[model samples]
Target: MSTVKQLIPHDQALLVTGSLNAMEDDRGHDDRSLIHPVQIVLDGDVINCSCFDSLGELGVSALVVVQKDPLVTYITTGADLIELSIENDGSAQVRRIEIPALKDVHEMSLLDGVLWLANTGYDEAVAIDLDEKCVVKRIVLGKFRGKIRASLPSFTGNDIQAVDRYHCNQVFQDINGKLCALVHHTSGKQLLKRIARKVIKSQGDGGVVDLDTGQAVSLSLKGPHSVRCVNGDYWVCDSGSRMLNVYDATWRLKNRLPTHGWGRGADFSKHHGLYYVGISAERKRYRDRPDYNDRNLIEVFKTDDGELLGEIPIVDGIEQINNVYLLQRGVVETLLGLKLSSWV
Candidate 1:
């Protein structure tokens, strides 16, 4: 007789996915080394999983769930983009969309049928027209901040076109539909220096930038990677600092939750009144740290009191995680080709 693991029944669940081994080198900038990207659906402590053979490799760095006919979900490899159309029976069909302007697509947001992607390779966030299937506009972080692109002659290319300048990796849209961006460094020179050393320090220089009004807001962050506006509050993954930074609608720093491992992705479950956070284990970058052996884990916390609830550890197969999303109860599974049952 086979043993079946039992877990607490939960209505809402979190879907955590990532680029396996993406963060092993180059501060996770080198996509070529990433592979075997996987997605795991967590219900309480039990889980169901699937891989990304049909979706393209080098690890899925960004994801967004769309509620529509057939229930669509979008994912990216920081370069290529794909979407899955899922049916009610938990089966899905994947489609790849090739856009020349899509370079190093990272954390993404969908608003009004338009997909806003963090084009980290180009140092800008690009707005892709879903209907037209083309890049409608590129919001250059430096230019959007009302600053000129750095023109240092020593560099092989212009600072604006340099890969990971500002390391602008996440895009967020406000309640009014205004676009905002999160970047690593505000100064091009400083960004270059950090790149040369291949180190992302707690510089407190990284923050949120208002792409429309050319405004910048610093929240004393360090290597901040993910940004989102949740329930009238701005939530950020201060990755380098290993903390979840929350800001009020007025942009004031509200609450900070110290996290385990490298904090990158987060999602709040409105129905469950809980917050799920992705905690990636320390890699070669933090080689000297003692927590290197720890596995990549997703932690749950009570939204009302910030109390620790439980943890879903990703053991075996997956190496690094980039994002976690809440799939409320009945959304279709985004991944296909798995033998696991939907209720597992």
Candidate 2:
């Protein structure tokens, strides 16, 4: 049996994004089905699950809590965006915005009121003006063949051909306040050509790039997913290597911690003085050994010493976790509006 430690404070909760698992048996079921993408709130032993019923058949990738007073959250589901607002009484309201240009959208970062989305399929980072609800800018990356436009007057999902050249998965604000993107496979276009010829297998060719200058900031990574700046240090989830890499302000690797599974989502909780890293079960194509049922878990580590504290299994029909965010429990409670029941 798995035991959970009471590391999280009572005042805070973790808002987690569980990506859709198409491998599950109940793929085409209704909204109540657990195989679809979901937003989960973890408060100590209690777990609150929320599924988007209005938005049908979309995979929830990443989300950001833009406001806390009314508990407003923006979630990325494939090419669509969901605006979720929670009232004081705990009722939830959802607004879906369709952006056809975005494909395989992943992590997002908010800077100066603009939301930067990693449009993975198109190998671009798209900037959306929240108030205006329009695509303000698009930063093309990694051997994209499509024509670059200075500005998009309207959302055209079909204007550009979708290709996952770089597999650009995450976009976040660096310590210097500049936007940076984590490309899962930096040389993805070359790798795709090699794959067509059946010559070589995909290897670790991932790196981080500064969106402003369109230059690589960090290199020699394997399937990098998320990046966060904590106390002047950059933490990256080197997923393909199943390692948590820490880099100094100069982008020098300071430490590397081995996570048993494929490391993906990551966040630091200042209130708890710890770091939470999400790991998913290794895919069959990448695994050298048999799969482990208990591989999908969250690894908690001490911030100061990088000590492995404990592991929290993500069960209850959640097959994979994409992102993790630590927020106030009061806010989540208000947003969920659910009575505390039993431990997960």
Candidate 3:
């Protein structure tokens, strides 16, 4: 039995898909290695294998995973894909596709056969075709607020302020289909003052920018990572400083929950009628490449009173996961382990 597990509500029980990976260098050898790319699915009552083969390294760096009908895509920093073909027997084969123009694609989404990706290194968003593995369109938010693509978040739960920092944050889509964007600006004096608080500064603009109209708006936060759409509202998680900021669908910061306990990725849990955030290590800093197998675990908390709920300890030395979308249905487990040609 796996000791590592996630916590679910009373109506929604916990399930272990065991869809995961092995730390390539389990022995703590001098040489850094990689285990075959792996993933898993944990349905309410069933846990099955995934249909993916190509462990495109991009998905790991971006910290992204999403399953669309008939397809599952992983986007890493290299802006690549670990494509798979789902078979009748629930097995999968991997297909490699490289995406250009993305310096570093962090997060991705699939809607209406279109793959929406955020370029973490660049201030842009790209949509691609899964079948053809080609670029369809691109949205370049030149100098949008500070690395607009660090970690794009997608919300399937209630509006509990999922994230607060630039990374692992989400973008919202309103009724008109226009994207909610951060309008940004900066003052050298103001920035220098904020530096005292250890604020993560953006290379793009100093403030938030509008997505469609490209307007500048005043936003407040210690740090804002990802944005998620929940029940016609938006949840913002600022993991850098451990705060959850709320926003209306119109892109206004409305409510805030201080780091009552811990939260990396937060969402409103319908089953419990409260907001929940998946908490993990704040972020690790290695002095001289510290040992990998020391301590790596994850936790959960309530967004309402900031109560500690559960803990998940993974063996892969993964310490930077903010949220996990646990649905009533199981995972998109069409893909299996890969038969790689050679990862480069």
Each model's C-alpha lDDT?
A: 0.65, 0.67, 0.43
lDDT string for model 3 (180-289, tens) is 44322221111221333343333222234446654544454344545565656666555544566666766676676554323444445655644545444333222244
User: What tens-digit string does per-residue lDDT give for candidate 1 at 48-162?
Assistant: 3444533435557777876655678777878877776677666666677776766767688887788988888878888888767678888777665336232322333333233
Q: Name the better of 1 and 2 by TM-score.
A: 2
lDDT by residue for model 2 (1-344), tens: 22354766666767666655544442333343554344444544646454342333444678788888788888876677778777777666767665667777778888888888989878888888888777888888853323221211122332232234667887778788877778755433324223343333344667776666666643567678888888889888887677898899888999998887878788888656789888876553344565443456788887777888888777654456777877776766665563323211
Sorted by lDDT (best first), the order is: 2, 1, 3
Q: Evaluate model 1: give its TM-score.
A: 0.79
Best by lDDT: 2
Scored against the true structure, residue 15 in model 3 reaches a CA lDDT of 19
Q: What is the lDDT of residue 133 in candidate 3?
A: 77
In order of appearance, the predictions have TM-scores of: 0.79, 0.81, 0.61
- C-alpha lDDT of residue 141 in model 3: 60
Q: Note the clash tally of each candidate.
A: 1, 2, 41
Model 1, residue 176: distance off in Å is: 4.9
